[model samples]
Target: MKRKVLSIILAAALTGTMLAGCGSSAKQETPAVASDTGAPVSEQPAESSATQTGTSGKQTDGKNVPELTSEPLTITLWDISTEDPGKTTMEEAVQRFMADYPNITINQVHQQNDNYKQQLVVAMSSKQAPDMYIHWGGGPMAEYYKSGFVNDMTEMFNTYDHPDFIDAAVAQSTYDGKVLAIPFGGLSGCDIFYNKTIFAEVGVEVPETIDDLEAVCDKLIEAGYVPFALANGSKWTGSMYYMYLVARHSGNEEFDAAYTQEGSFTSDAFIWAGNKIQDWVKKGYFPDGVNSLSTDDGQDKALLYDNTCAMMLHGSWQVSGIRADNQEWYDENIGVFRFPEDSEAAAKGVPQDVEIGTAIGNGFSFNCWNADGSVDQTKLDACYVLATQYFNDDAYNQRRLDNGTIPSIKGFENTIDDANMKVVADIFFNASNVQLWYDQYLPASVTEVHKNCMTELFGLQKTPEEIGQEQDAAMKASLAE
Candidate 1:
């Protein structure tokens, strides 16, 4: 498939609305030394006007900062942000970066969410990877790093003085002790977001256990509400439940062992998770035709907005969309809660406080070398600068906050005024253990089995045992490959 390259001029026009919301601001102070987390020094150091040569062979200032090249260069940036806010934030950030470094041209490409991972893999294999791209840093990125398709950004991260990123956020992009990507938005994790009005009407408080959640669902159903709004057609949305259940049942150790091929994927915990999802389906907890609902056009959200559903389990990113749909409803009616723990797991000594999702945030990765194994030093340097300026720059970080995103950058949390966003951020900050999303944490082939089996399990076409066996077979196959 041919990739579409968007023009900078067209991008500017499309993002005018976002530009209006994210009005231009004065540049902020640069950090002196980089750390994964905590506040950095706010004072800017004085520098000589004359450029100095650095030992790394790059042109530098008196502070040893690499000077940008004057030669015209066009770099492509691939990201999965086809909607507003994210798209706009990215475009506006790029435009600003371009204005600062006139010689650098960015051809920003937006790919559909579902197509992004596969497309990136193909592009990398074909030696057509973009110079820089937004990616979920975990197993998939580690794969790319192993194949030598990703750049090690540790030096640049250190060179840029660390930028007040969260430790978990930085660790997500690090592979083999090398930072491979820049941490962008805030750390993300999945949780149950409920309609306060619906819960109030049903006289049910936020659930704290599997039984409580089921009781709440029953109440919602009895009160003529869809118990849960699930976009299982996307598969990954449904997988969240399974992932959480498995986490509750088995915890991270067993899951990691299976992922690493040290244990079997067809464990009791995996089977129980699959069975529970099927049980939920049989109990009418999910809406009719949930298997056909699409998460991509906000269809799942529509259920909550229309008052058809009482709750939905989703990631922190959902806050932005909900706020956009109805700010008042989001502020006054939305309530966030962690996914309740399974009683069986709790009885078995599994900690209820452990979260089932990852603390990793999304960020951009630079393609260090060309397909034929050639390095473009100038392009690499420019890519790092672009990534840093767009994500770590304080002004752009404010834009992220305004967009209802929890920034991975430190100290930006104080700027967050959105109550709904703050709730999500609190959950992220308080999570005892944040397990990476299964599809993103496991190998690609294993992820495929996970999603497919989840879909089948939800559809009631496969038993939990069958799904576990299928997943195990796929995992073994991937390991053999």
Candidate 2:
């Protein structure tokens, strides 16, 4: 419970990156693809409710879905969709599912984002694990699967009719060559959501390179605005900065090598990411006690709301959170922009366009087990129905779109009319590759190390080398096991 990373080997190889939790690297890289139509994933639909083929050769309609029991049953479903649009969207889905299946009831639990992984780890290690839960698929999900905390949904997925999810989303959800979880969360892209009014007032253009970004930060600071609204209490917020730095400095190859142990975390890119974060801290580019600001308490948004901060580099879901809280303010101020490229690095042939975020936002993996650890067949079928049928159906997706989410399914572009959402979708659509977050990508023990390192790195308590060395040590320990 002290950390999210557990130094143990999964039965299969590990894969993932920092998102909302901690973890190690993949033994093999999953190919990043877009839609089946080879179009940008952001241009994809949420759900068509049209006929589609399952992974297995068979296709299915509602009548062919495995029947649920008539006996009264209660199940718990956990996720970090604690805020609006996501929260309301999920609640509605569960309501619809239960309305149809009158004998079954789902207890949907919305956990705070900051403590979700740690709490889920504790739940799985004890008797309190939920029947089904949302997770950012990567090494930690692999850890959960290997530790017997989750069911292998491959067979169920293949047997059920699912939305034609983008190839990248499916690939991210699959682990060790099998479908371990369903991609219920939308295609998540992380970018800097800035106050357009601030830029206009400051007489600076949106940055297109790291250098330009720094210049903009300098001007923002001169204007007495915090350049970035960072609530590192969630840790993953800071991890985005580090991941983007690594991506721009050396592209995905460096992180990929570090993950596979083919290279070191002390690689130039990692070192650069660490030092750059520290430098930003010293430059007063961030707020005081940035790490102490709790994202769950809306502390970061508070900064944005008051105009104390001009920009927030965060997940696309913030569109909904911001819009839900103060629609007028969001419409008038907030705008989206991808993390700027490293122009100098690009000159050296280091591709600066690789994206850092999630193709699969959060995956839903079931844990339907009876006492003595035997599988609960009846509950598994019902849970799978909820996940595939209820969660990703047209109704569920329309709510997501209305809330401004672009799911990883093809053909839904017309539903998104928000200017901010359009920019985010375009970023995802144009990205050649998408990297999952490190906290979600690494194993438990390594994730703890990574998250802690981000805190220390941004706090300037540890040098980049020191942080990288610690991460490397954690990675080696996990790999050895």
Candidate 3:
């Protein structure tokens, strides 16, 4: 079944009192009264657990007893992506949690992604962050941790003996060598998805190098097809292409170095890559008016579904959505390819870079606790079981695979029915090196600047040199931070 986004709309008019009471924001104060006694202040638990089979597929050994003792415990938890008013999938998941442990009542709150970020900032400044809430780990989470908005869960994480993921996702969730939060899952980026039917129709073959790719694009154009469909208006969507080019041209090490080591965007690697992209744009390799494309408006999909564009480079998760939207097109015509090997560039044009699985999308970063920086031993114990168990659960792995999401867990394979998606999966699983999204590793504002500059370059509004200067300045500022 297609999992729909939760539609529950929360009132943005949040009060300081509500934020503290629900444990949904960072305004919570660890009070001395609550810490000293270690006695039950209220009768309710903050979070409830479910009695599902363990990751081993055996019945739980019954370690925790679900009893609602008269202890004053309030857990402020918030969830974004549960804004849908009709039927909340996560709420249903939370309900299952309630069923196992009837004593704990979650003071559950919901927010949209953008709004949640803004409000979370406020909660952090006010020192009232939720006992536990969903958060992105890298930048924002790091900032919040520095501000003392959330408690460290390192001990809790170690106690659980978290399983090793093939992609080493644990490291991404860690900050400055401290394991901050549990990673829910991660996305593998830059897999080339193509239409076999289009290839056959245009008599073009999938290329394996920069030159080969250019040759194929030229053939597709001569046959009256847009070589690729890129959505620049959505911003990040367009960065997918630029990142691939950079990784293929400059190589992962240097490209990554630029983010860490202060360097000019006009450096040899940057100029070479920027010039290549501008050249492609000038040649009309991408679809016309791509700058105005809306990610949600079906324009990008039309490029694929209507057979206007031949390929798209994105994370593997889109396979299920595309296949569900047009099964026939996916079944017969679609194919997947890795970024063609770039022998000339410093970073092997190869997609994977083992340093850290760099890719896009957010995942769980940290687990929170009650006010006064106290962990309800009972709840913490339950949470440990849930996180580690879910990480390796076969059913959970299967569900993600069914959605065309490639799991980094060792045994989880792509189970999508489409041959194209399966081929993509093989390339992903076998990739000797897998780097996470390049943009993901950058400071958010700088990544945005890169995206905007790439778009302007595509539109011929910015010269290659001009883009190099602006992007170099932005990266310099970010590095200073």
- Which candidate leads in lDDT? 2
Q: After superposition, how far is residue 169 of candidate 3 from its true place, in Å?
A: 1.1
Question: lDDT tens digits, residues 30-108, model 3?
Answer: 1111212221121111223523233232212322222233344444566675532212534554454445444556676
List, residue by residue over 199-223, the lDDT tens digit for candidate 1: 8888999988888998898888888
Q: Please name the candidate that would achieve the greatest TM-score relative to the true structure.
A: 1
**Quick one: how many clashes does candidate 2 have?**
26
TM-score of each: 0.85, 0.83, 0.76
Model 1 alpha-carbon miss at residue 246, Å: 1.1
Error of 3 at 215 (Å): 0.6
* Model 2 agreement with the true structure over 94-146: per-residue lDDT tens digits: 98887777688899999997667778877765557899999888777777776
lDDT of 2 at 306: 95
In model 1, pairs of residues that clash are: 34-161, 34-162, 357-435, 358-435
Q: Worst 10-residue stretch by lDDT in candidate 2?
A: 22-31
| TM-score computed on alpha carbons, candidate 3 | 0.76
Candidate 2: where are CA atoms >4 Å away?
A: 1-64, 71-74, 81-85, 126-128, 369-376
Better of 2 and 3 by lDDT: 2
Off by over 4 Å in 3: 1-89, 107-110, 113-119, 135-137, 161-164, 346-361, 367-386, 390-395, 414-418, 478-481
